[model samples]
Target: MVLLTLMAAVTIGIVRARNLFAVVVLSGIYSFLMASVMIVLDAVDVAMTEASVGAGMSMVLMLGVLYLTKVEEAVPSHTPWLPLFVAVGTAAVLLYGTVGLPPFGAAENIVHAHVAPRYLEQSIAETTVPNVVTSVLASYRGFDTLGETVVIFTAGFAVLLLLRGRRRSRPSDDA
Candidate 1:
């Protein structure tokens, strides 16, 4: 509960901050807070991922982006109320859409009866992994996880290449 509050506060801070550097730092802090929440929920694999990629690598990447750009955010030229209304409308629609979903953690959910039981029962026998998440993500969902990882790495690489190219293409003022 306290971690969730802190995350909300950090989010507000990020939104209110005009400095891009501060927003990036606060976003990293938010990721760490989310990782803590994941740990508290006993999702250690998710926590590790949030800490490593979300808090660690993402901050480093954003910081690198900061290095290549201005630290302060420019003032908006247009009024934000229209965009705010659109965002609120989207959120309301999404929330309404979720009303038909089963209550969270309900064992009666159809999907829970399927692979979850298998993961809980035979995962250890099949993968020798004591951790169900580890077995599920690394074994059962291995290809999916691998593909997602590849996509993330590829996106990061693309961002780096674009930033580097932009830098090199700029005319040197010192000349």
Candidate 2:
């Protein structure tokens, strides 16, 4: 509950912040808080990934972009009512969608009843991996993991290309 409150506060801070740097820092804090929540939920692997990718690499990337841009966001000439309405609508829809989800950690949940047991019982024999989680991610869901890796790699490569283009477009001091 406390972690969720902190996460909500951080989210509010991020939304209310006009300073780009402060927003980035707050986003990192939010990511760290989310990682802590994941840890509390017994999702250490997810927590580690969230910390490293969300808090670590994302911060570094945003800071790099900030170095090349203004620290403060420009005030818009007009109120963003359409975007505000869209955001509220999306949130409402998402909340409505979650209403049908099984209670958290419920033993009779679909994953618990069908997926987890299969992984726990057959993981070692099928994958020769002692860790059930490892077997599930590496062997059972290898294609999914690979797809995620490809997406991340493509995004990083695109960012690098954009930064390179910006550098090339700038006038060199030595020239």
Candidate 3:
């Protein structure tokens, strides 16, 4: 409940903040809170990724964008009703789905009985890594991590391209 409240407040702050820096900071706060929620939900890997990418990398990129652009701008008018309706509808659907979820760590869950157990048991032998999650991320599913790295690289490259200044070449005197 507290995390939900924090997320709501951060969303409002991000929308209402006039200063770009304040908005960026609020966004970082939102990401951090979301990471905490993921941790509480027993998704440590997701939490780590969110903390690093959403909070750290995103804040750095936002700051770079702000540095490349003007600090102040005229406020644009936007109607919030459509977005509010969509958000509420999505939340309602998610809540409805949550009602059908098996209790966390229930033995009858296929997740625990089938997939997770194999990963837990075989990962050490397969990868010679003590941490099963790390082994899975780095060895068992390396291609996915490579793809993610490429995506982040692409994002950084795009940001650099956006911020790069174009120089005009002078016509040669001989020409």
Candidate 4:
């Protein structure tokens, strides 16, 4: 709970920051903290992913972007109240929606009743894999995993294409 509170504070700091570099650093810290939270929740695989992709690769990418751009954010021209009100309104609606959800970690949840048992009992036979984790990811969820990979590749390719074509301003150019 303490760690989660710290993460929220760091997130608020990230949002309030005017220095883009400081924002990037805080974002990395948030990812690392999130990874820690995942670990505490006993989702080590997800924690490892958060650490590597969220903290590691994202920081590298953000640093590369910062190298090519200004470190400070430009001031906004309009009042922020409208956006803030909208955000609070949306959050209230979402919270109200979750009020109908079953309590967390309840063993009688639908997933525990149906999907998990099937995976444990039949995953190896259907997928012909010795490891449950391997069979689940590479066979059961294979299409979804492949889709994620392709999407990531496409996004990276698009970013490279866009960055490659960026026109740097000349020192002699005058208004």
Instruction: Enumerate clash totals for all models, in the order shown.
Output: 0, 0, 0, 0
Q: Against the true structure, what is every candidate's RMSD?
A: 3.8, 3.2, 6.0, 4.4
Candidate 1 local lDDT, 145-167, one digit each (tens): 99989998998788667667556
Candidate 2 lDDT by residue in tens digits, 1-175: 8999999999999989999999999999999999999999988989999999999988997897787767999888999999999999999999999999889887778877767888989987788898777888888999999998999899878867766765666745210
- For TM-score, candidate 2 versus 3, the one ahead is 2
Clashing pairs in 1: none
Task: Count residue pairs with overlapping backbones in model 1.
Answer: 0
Q: Which of 3 and 4 is ahead in lDDT?
A: 4
Candidate 1: C-alpha RMSD after superposition: 3.8
List where candidate 2 sits over 4 angstroms from the true fold.
166-175
Among all windows of 10 consecutive residues in model 4, the one with the lowest summed lDDT is 166-175
Q: Pick the candidate with the highest lDDT.
A: 2
Task: Evaluate model 3: give its lDDT.
Answer: 0.83
| Candidate 3 lDDT by residue in tens digits, 92-138 | 99999999888876678867776678878998788889788898889
Better-scoring candidate (TM-score), 1 or 2:
2
Model 4 misplaced stretches (Cα beyond 4 Å): 124-131, 166-175
